[model samples]
Target: MVAVTDKSILGCRYGSSQPQRDTVLYADLYREGRLLLDELVTETYPVEDFAKAADDAHHGRVARGVLVF
Candidate 1:
């Protein structure tokens, strides 16, 4: 199961009951330079090119993208 709780800002998958713990663990990993989130962003585009970004994402051309304003 997967869930996201706004109050705790927790997101979990695979039936994890300890979402809070997972959040902390991930935070620690990021701080330790183990989680490379920037590498996941394969593309970035200005908000003006939102349509292009969306298209690329839909076409599987973009693995992950950030739309900047």
Candidate 2:
């Protein structure tokens, strides 16, 4: 495993049944879905071109890159 030297880098469990494991704000969730429907959140990428998606993400070209089946 690669250890990040940046102190600003933090890690946390995103979703867990454990109490206080992660609390997703309702407004944030609603906004995410709403933005997606409005084509403001992200764009879908073809599954076959996954490498391109990765490259775009590495270059900070996307908010969220989804591979469509």
Candidate 3:
């Protein structure tokens, strides 16, 4: 077996220089129902059950899992 590598593929870490502005924009979108976080969450678990959520995610059972405080 031979391994092929793609030099075009690159990974970069990203951060927001204006986090506050981004936060406000997202908040507005959420408030308007344009960004439905509930729709993105497949399931939610209490903080104590984080391991369960992690397992579900690893097994491809969950796309998004919310860990509530």
Strongest candidate by lDDT: 1
- C-alpha root-mean-square deviation, each candidate: 10.3, 10.0, 6.6
**What is candidate 1's TM-score against the reference?**
0.56
Off by over 4 Å in 1: 1-14, 46-49
- Residue-level lDDT tens digits of model 1 in 1-69: 978676555666767558778889888999999998888899999999999999999999989999998
Cα lDDT tens digits, model 3, 15-58, are 43466688898889999999887888899999999899999999
Give candidate 2's whole-model lDDT.
0.71
- Winner by lDDT between candidate 3 and candidate 2: 3
TM-score of each: 0.56, 0.44, 0.70
Those runs of model 3 whose alpha carbons end farther than 4 Å from true positions after fitting are 1-17
Q: Taking the tens digit of each residue's C-alpha lDDT, what string does model 2 give over 1-69? A: 989785695667744445443234544666677423446547788899999999998999998888889
Give each model's whole-structure lDDT: 0.89, 0.71, 0.87
Report how far off residue 46 is in candidate 1 (Å): 4.5
